[model samples]
Target: MTASGALDAPAASRPMPSLAAFTQRLRDRLIMQEDPATAAYDRIMRRLGISIGIAGIIVGGVELPEVAEQGRYAPAWWTVAAVVLAFGWYPIIAVVSAVSGPRAIRFVCGCAAMSFLGALASIPFGLKLHTVDATTVWPFRVTALAVTAAVLAWTSRVTVVYLLTAATSAALATVYTVSAVTPQHVTENFLRSAGLAALFVWCGTAATGAAARVDRESAIASRRAASQAAAHSRDRERARFAALIHDAVLSTLLEASRAGTKSDVLQRQAERTLEQLDECRGAQRDPDLLDARSAVLFLRAAVHEINPSIRFATRTWPGYDDLRMPVHSASTIAAALTEAVRNSLRHAAVPGREVRRTVTATVSAGSIRIVFTDDGAGFDLAAVSADRLGISMSILGRMRQLAGGSAFVESQRGEGTTVTLVWGGDGSR
Candidate 1:
């Protein structure tokens, strides 16, 4: 890639990279490294845990007084035990069996067992409470129903059938308990319980469907990204290999074809072939390996296409020789500087005269900084509009995206401009 276009395309010719592509960029963006399925599941579990805790607290408090008053029949301790196990089950097991293959099945079975046995134990006591005081203690049972639904929604890797089955168990428990305790309003109580069960099942089904959609989309995006990345890598490698062949192998082969069998010519040709082989090997090394010197060389080569009138100068900090950096970072810095230098050549000029520019690089304890300065007419930053995105996007934007990197621009009319690109080892120097 050309130096100017490496980090960003010319804004005038093309729009900035789309958000999808920006987010999907290889090697530095975390989106490429994260699994969306895992993230979505974590969110689901967190929401489920929070909702369960809140529901348990509210319902348990509301039902506590009635359950406590009827201690002769519905012992307070047993009610507390059921509440603790019923509400706390999912939150505990969700964490413990988070990655377990049978977690969904276990959760479904557990919810059903809790609702059934809990209703059986408490319904008789609730009937006694109603007989004595006409008061109902169904909050604990209702809370169980709601929490079970939430648990089902959260851990629903199993088919919708499991949710339906749990909802059926909860409905039957509610109907049995309500019908046994309050025979006069059996229909109303049964409908309420069945409605709650149906509502929860519907909620669980909807949540499961939504989560499945997210997982599906994430999987598709990941596969597409991987396929595209592989294809792009192959294309880039092919181009680089072709360049190596043209620059070294082809030239040497052509010379060998033209030269007669003179000893000197043959000897030189053989030496060139060996050198070419070495270069090919070097090219195949880790592509990101780069040093300050090499970065400067790349910057020089990249700027060679600009007008020759504007002179380019580069210098390194003393005693900090051979500053090594990630190849990707080095390339980004080089590209940014190349753009800065070109901008200087194009805009940093007197009415009819060229100006000189300098690119200085300094290495410190854990960071590197490069500054491009030129003595040319500089425009006001505020006067620039959104459409003029070259410096804003191609240079500053790209630098900011690099890990622990930042870019700044300082310019005043007649005083010229200075664009600084700095990168540190842990995002700060």
Candidate 2:
């Protein structure tokens, strides 16, 4: 399907949105809500995280027992240690709560703190809980696994949290399970968690890499399209201007010169014709109208060549310099709209002995807007899928290559069609 038809089809079969979409949305919203001043928020978070980490180490040593053993029991100091952990954790939680972006950073912080504290407190792991039910520690294990999985899911970063959390959970679960502690189901769990975490990391990374590649390819395609269009327009302009010189000024001057019988009179007329030709040519050749004028000159010259009675009116497009857009962006906008004009002119009916066709070009911020309203009867743009596709794909496709910009056509029988094209962020000479 052409780019246009591709745009008009049903929406049900679209691919699932990418994980990158999550981060993009987060960042966009963050920028919108807090603006760039939120950079200070990140700095403050980092400082708080660091301070919290230092406090954990100091309090862990002070409140927890000096000796450590895991298999037999809980420490007399477990409550005191939990109290200290709660105090230190609150500041980091507050930082995370205020953060306006991807919670991947917060997840990492929480996981690291949980894993470190859980493992170290295991210094007295076996000291208490002589006969505990396996189901009792189940939540702890599950929470550990979930948090580790979440970190892997969100950030795709490899960390010791996975091993530390997994090990602690499995250890506690194994100690309490009624069976002979067969590695069968328990080992399977370890392998399963590892596998899931690995898959998430791989998928996230692969998706991110693919997205970047697509973006680069799109950018390259846009540049090439613009360059080809610009080159084509330039060539078309020269052809039309050459034709104009040949017909009006060049032919008149040549004919006058050939009539030497009225030599002085003819010579004066020839000189006047030559001067007029130069002035007209200079106006047509103004670089500001290079591509826009190309379309006008080419359309008018070609139509007139076919039939003198056919009148084509074209107004020179405004200079793009005022927009100050980047070159590729400008080129894409100009090229797409130029092609649309060509298509509109080509599609119009030419049955009459006398025909009047009008084409106008408008340039606005980073967009080359063109409307070719003609006297010819117009077709239902929506009904004609092929022609509609031509506009969307040829025109809109060009715009899409410019950061997914848009192109559309509005038409009515006996009225006319209007084609709109928009290019991204910048479009200027």
Candidate 3:
């Protein structure tokens, strides 16, 4: 067995790794180590949270004096504690959530809930929180609207309804807390506070929803690309296997049948066919690259194996002998060329007519080209059936599967036939 095969056998038989192998994965993500699956959503949420936190800090700083002035109407300790809870906690949590993970997000949600509840609780105690009068507006009232709306941005529709209900109730309570409540005052304050909350809700929901959709679509596209690559790889392997059977095993059987079972040439060919099959079974390692000289020699041996009488020639440009290509490309071209020669040998030899077959391989700095010509009983290319896999799958499809590889066939009824295979520069067409 090959070294790679020996190593892979043990790995393939081993059990899957335990869940403990991934324990640090969450910690890594909390520190901003991105997971490709949720990268888009995480990026959007991180930026949104940081922006809202910064905005909250700015609003809190601007409203500090008013908050302090309103403290006279409430207990001194309650006023200081409420200010910290309503204004200080959430913004810090929101900013830290960018690196802190889901618990920080939950804390921000708690802050939103507590701010609305605190406004309602202060009414019975004569705290006058969230009250709007001729001279002053409650600072907590304004900042609470922002904090609650920020939560709504990332929450579900059901939670949105619940939070909005709490906000509306708080707005109504603040209106009643005014010394002389009027229908006009209640309607105006209710609409202003609730309307601003609704606007933030709508904007936040839309932005977050769009970010989620982007992440979903990106994951789908990634899966589809991977599936397509796998399918192409499978198709290439199938083509290579089919070519091997057609060129080596079948050809050996035909020669053995024509020459007698006891023939030495038939025995040798059968042994070579068995060795090729064994190699194919273990061909799991990465293929080695082939330089120009090595590729030419390999092609010459391949052609001679099929038809010893066929003329073969090689032409290499100066300073291009060191040019290299993937081994798969070389193998694909060799298989296609051999298939073309087999087709010529089977169909071109007419009774009482001399047939000449030649293969020419040309190597340049950026490309490799091979031409196969036969001066024999040529057939029309248009009359060939689509199901004739010798031409379609083995020769054409095989080369087409290789990157930057192509094949062409040209023939006329009374003239000659030419099969051309190319790789690299100008081969895409």
- Give the TM-score of each candidate: 0.42, 0.40, 0.52
lDDT per residue (tens digit) for residues 133-171 in model 1? 432344435533553544453444442344444445544
- Candidate 2 ranges with C-alpha deviation above 4 Å: 1-73, 76-132, 135-180, 206-229, 244-429
Q: Looking at candidate 1, what is the lDDT of residue 134?
A: 30
Q: For candidate 3, lDDT tens digit of each residue in 1-429?
A: 000111112322333255622422222233222333454555556666666667667777877777677666667876676666556655665656555543455567556556646755565465654453433236425634554445533466755665566566655665555556667766676666667766766666676678779868865654453344344445655787899899999999899778754988778889998998998786542334555666676778778977899898888887575456655566668778877887777565544556777888888877888999876655557756565456777788878888888998886544557889988743322
For residue 133, model 1's alpha carbon misses the true position, in angstroms, by 7.9
Task: Pick the winner on TM-score between candidates 1 and 3.
Answer: 3
> How does model 3 score by TM-score?
0.52
Highest lDDT against the true fold, candidate? 3
lDDT for 5 in candidate 2 is 15
Model 2 quality (TM-score): 0.40
Q: After superposition, how far is residue 25 of candidate 3 from its true place, in Å?
A: 20
lDDT computed for candidate 1: 0.52
Tens digit of lDDT per residue, candidate 2, span 1-429?
Answer: 011111122231233156743543333232222211133343333334444445444544543332232222445475345344333453444344334332444664555546444643443343333243232232232333333333322434443455445555555554453234454756665665556645544543454445446546645655564455456655766776778677766777677667757666667767776776686666453233334443333334433433445344433335543332344455555555545454445454334322244444444433444444444434454544342334555566667777536666665544445565544343332
Highest TM-score against the true fold, candidate: 3
Q: Which pairs of residues collide in model 3?
A: none
Candidate 2 has its poorest 10 consecutive residues by lDDT at 1-10
Full candidate order by TM-score, most accurate first: 3, 1, 2
